[model samples]
Target: MLWLKERGIASVAESVLNSEELDKTVAHLLVAARNDGYAQGYAECSHHVVNALKVDWDTSKSATHGVNTEVALAAAKMQFNNLQLPVMDLIDVALHSEDHVAQLKEIFPDRQEDEDEDLA
Candidate 1:
């Protein structure tokens, strides 16, 4: 996301980017929010929380192709069901899915980035 990217955390591999890093990134945003500075940013509290879930890398591997997005999306769907979002809320699910994919894309923009960043 443009907003999250601005935080300089956008470069971190989304896979293996656990909730800790995400939470730290969010903590900074929360401070900005309390100061009313994050209002102009793209991510809101709910979006950040959902993004955190959608981007979870709780497994033992790094970015895997269709796997990450698919699983994350399916999980988000189940979460939406629990949240009781209406059928018209398809957009929300799709948006979160996009967020998941974007996170993946940001993960491996180039294969060499890992070795370069010492993430491998």
Candidate 2:
């Protein structure tokens, strides 16, 4: 009887430890996902800003001898500010994207694979 009780306690302890490890893994994955989403959003916004600046500079050069540094800086700053909302929206969409789901599955495949096997 004592051996059985000790075995039961050991089993419960192992289960709790496994649960904690799983929780930690999930937390790490969520942080990674958020970082990746934010990076994608910022990269997209930066690309747009760069393309716009290129076009603006090209037009300005054709119209004038040279671009004004102060005006260019101000315009770029204003455009960046205008894009804040779109950047946030992109980040939100990225977080909920199929790519994000695939990323999570890629990072943690063993459990899902096992479940798939069980179902089959």
Best by TM-score: 2
* TM-scores for the candidates: 0.17, 0.31
Indicate the worst ten consecutive residues by lDDT in candidate 1. 59-68
**Number of the top lDDT candidate:** 2
- Write down the RMSD of all candidates, one decimal each: 24.0, 18.5
lDDT of 2 by residue, 2-46 (tens): 422444345334544556544555555555555555555555565
> lDDT of all predictions, in order shown?
0.43, 0.47
Backbone clash numbers for all candidates listed: 0, 0
> Cα miss at 9, model 2 (Å)?
19
Which segments of candidate 1 are over 4 A away from where they belong? 1-18, 37-120
Ten residues in a row with the worst lDDT in model 2?
A: 56-65
